[model samples]
Target: MGRGQLVRQRVLVPLFGDVRGRVISWSSAGACGFKGTRRGTPFAAQTAAGNAIRTVVDQGMQQAEVMIKGPGLGRDAALRAIRRSGILLSFIRDWKCVESRADSKRLYYGRFILAPLMKGQADTIGIAMRRALLGEIEGTCITRAKSEKIPHEYSTIIGIQESVHEILMNLKEIVLRSNLYGTRNVSICIKGPGHVTAQDIILPPSVEIVDNTQHIANLTEPINLCIELQIERNRGYRIKTPNNFQDGSYPIDAVFMPVRNANHSIHSYVNGNEKQEILFLEIWTNGSLTPKEALHDASRNLID
Candidate 1:
């Protein structure tokens, strides 16, 4: 290990839930392995429980691939736990097998390839995806466009939006990841269910997040931390035009502008230099950062 170099650990937890039973197998960086168990369908309650367990297991692995299986509700929660624990996941797969074939099932193949962690970058965007079918799945955040109004055909959409709430939750994750890479400082703004529970949430050593979900999370306040962002006007420059309201709608692309608090609330593009820049963030509410705070944010570039 070189001086001041940081060592990263990755861990994987197999989640099998709602199959009338469930179990967890864990392995560590240098240690052998450990196993644990929980009873029941591994439904919602089990999912929540499994999330906590996955987090504990993740803390020990330097690199991990979570192979989850079974017909259970907890699979998604397990993934969430892995993300929250700061263990960068290599992939999420369903390793369950089915007995349908006779000859084809006997075929053997060997192909090894290591995929980098880029697509998983979406993990940095954390809003719960609204889904219908209960199958092996990946999640996506709701955009007001496709998600603005629940289609007349689907009554369940209303319930989905209610549980997940609004505003993509993954922005916090995205911002945190950027900060970790010395790209952007975090300025959290969030609010939602289990408000009191937010305070208990944990974060990485250097990541910053605000839990506005009913002000549930206690946040640290630095005397002077400022985040200066350079924004570009869209080709149409109609992102959030307060003046023109003709009732007729324009393609979202037509309003290409990306600004804080534009009509498309949380939709934005973080503009900055190509190389990650180290900067401090001064978080506040009710107004923009003040003059001194702005100066501090602009002047405190750590690397010469």
Candidate 2:
């Protein structure tokens, strides 16, 4: 017999097939009468796998090979259930597929699981961590830009495709990292008939750009574009104010949140006499910091 298991974030499906690759039986946690969030639990997956294996066992199936895919809590539980079904297992394979991209940087994403907490504690921790990650984590961003030729934000240069205001907006999207604190100055001096990206910016040794391919502006003709930028590391958002601009420089609203998104889910399970809960947390970042680092700093901030 051949078996396949598809484990998703909220569901588990097990399939049984004959020697010729014909599907003999299939079952899912939802089909096993598990409702709502309970359907995603490992216990529900265990029940589903047991039920499916029983049907195939009665049909004269003996040895089986299993293939499991995706990330979910049900993966290991389903495998255990299949093992306990009295069927000899030939092999078990875990499969994962990663897409290829032109960019050299890998996606910054992380998942964490915390378990065996008392009831109601998971939600409290989740809320606190989410707030800390989104509001308290420090990041580097361009807070001001200066150009001698461009007097104001609305001014436009001859060869540049974007206006001064638009260029500042694009600069705001650039993700940067720096080891040192306080404000620093950087400059971009590009002579175009070409595209200008984050890579063209001249930064200090302590600062680095996260994504070099991030587009800043396009120049249709050969013209010198010289601009100075002021970078700062801080937490949360900073609104533009009159005091930000000086000389020929224009102020840009800065965003210092390194974490792009964060969320959590709670799963409950029995722990002897008392019921316990598990916290599943996921974090996505802007490449300036890893999710693990963000989580650690957030937890530290909470402790402080």
Candidate 3:
């Protein structure tokens, strides 16, 4: 064998097991210069964990299983740093070393008191909590228009659509999908006037009127109708197909207006130049049914 081959064979390799064909990297507070009382601090632990993961990645490591030992302040901090590093973690298991049951109890009790006082110099925990509160929890709202009829003076269907859109904008929760082409998840019913029937009113895609009872009215009187919309909290627009309407029926062309919440206002650039609040005030209808027909049929079912 050549001299180079002999040297390579003699080199010592750290044994961290096959670990499911993954590279193993580890660190402790002591390694990051936390001495004495500071060794158990969360700050030292986070720094040490970050350095260890970086070293492993430099060695071409892509994923890992983390086995954390000891009940130290850095336990959670180190884990958070590892997650933020973008390395895929298979699993995390505790390998805590306990001297006795009494010692374990004391450590556990101490943690509850020391947790708030640790004052770690990191924002990971704060960011995590914020994401959980804002992104995890969802809210919903439903608005019903009781026997509201489109005025006969409405010259075009666009005028009626615009009025409905304005009413939706006054809501606090967002309308999921509204566009110039068509509205989704919005139901309308019209009845009690002219030749319009329940079937004549074209609903938005994925939207339907649950109640179908008609209220009698003469041709001279305005049609009695109801309009109900379901709204939800979302960071961006979400498209949904409501379970109520699924018989291949779809809404006429309409626009969705923005909710009138100051705190939830979203700003976007207009015409690629001016920055403006992304808000819509009116909805326009463009489908098979005319505005009068929609109002007539909608009056059939009154949403309680």
Candidate 4:
């Protein structure tokens, strides 16, 4: 009923079978006049598949299914050759890695494979999941900063190495995780003759910094530096608004997306007589959220 291709690193072999599991025709890259390194090339595989499919077609076959196995450069090429043969592909299956993991508290990486989907469904699910992960997930970020003596963003403190504006910019790079929602205030009072980092910021009980080593600013002299930060949990980026700032406070642009990157790929497979598709998704995050947690939340958002 369907053809099978066994692909190796150095060669490809296509086998045509009948409904009763009898092999009626078979061809390989080696049999197609390819030699040495050329036998493993995609062009050689395509030629081999084309020859095998042609033999099967001459036997009065109108439709075929393909079962692909192994890792090789010729897999896709062979499939392409089958598609060009004008045979209705009722099924296609490939075996590959389903998942990998490199997860931590602050940085997360995950791979997910969704399979047995009908044609076009993988792309639809992938698009919706990516959007939900990147646009709907909420994260915490510093939205405003207040300094007692520095009245404006351009002002500089005597002992600090960075200007007020520079310090505000550096604060945006800090990654923070919080269980609580809405607005909260956190302050840092550092008497510094050294470097200041995220660890120095005094956070509330419900919040913690993802990376304690993230630099904020440097202080050359032993001067008391007191600063207040207003943090908020929201979704997506928020530009600075004049209405949110008080006299001594300056607004900072906030990025509340915990998921740093998200993308997906579609694959095809077969189950029973149905031609199906699969989705391969990858997500990377700043450790504020785990990939699994982010995927679950994103799917829930799509569902809701």
Name model 2 segments beyond 4 Å from true: 1-107, 242-244
Q: Highest lDDT: which candidate? A: 4
Where does the lowest 10-residue lDDT sum fall in candidate 4? Answer: 2-11
- Residue 256 alpha-carbon offset, candidate 1, angstroms: 67
Ranked by TM-score from best down, the candidates are 4, 2, 3, 1
TM-score for each model:
0.19, 0.64, 0.26, 0.65
Q: Ten consecutive residues with minimal summed lDDT in candidate 3?
A: 2-11
Quick one: best TM-score, which candidate?
4
Clashing pairs in 2: none
Candidate 4 has a TM-score of 0.65
In TM-score terms, candidate 1 sits at 0.19
lDDT of each residue in 114-190, candidate 4, tens digit only: 65555765687689889999999999999888989687788888989999889999999889999767999999899
* Model 4 bad stretches (over 4 Å): 1-106, 242-244, 270-273
Tell me the tens digit of each residue's lDDT in model 2 across 144-253: 89988797788888889999888999999989988758899899999989999999999999999998999999999999999999999999998998766678888889
Between candidates 2 and 3, the one scoring higher on lDDT is 2
List where candidate 3 sits over 4 angstroms from the true fold: 1-24, 96-304
Ranking by lDDT: 4, 2, 3, 1
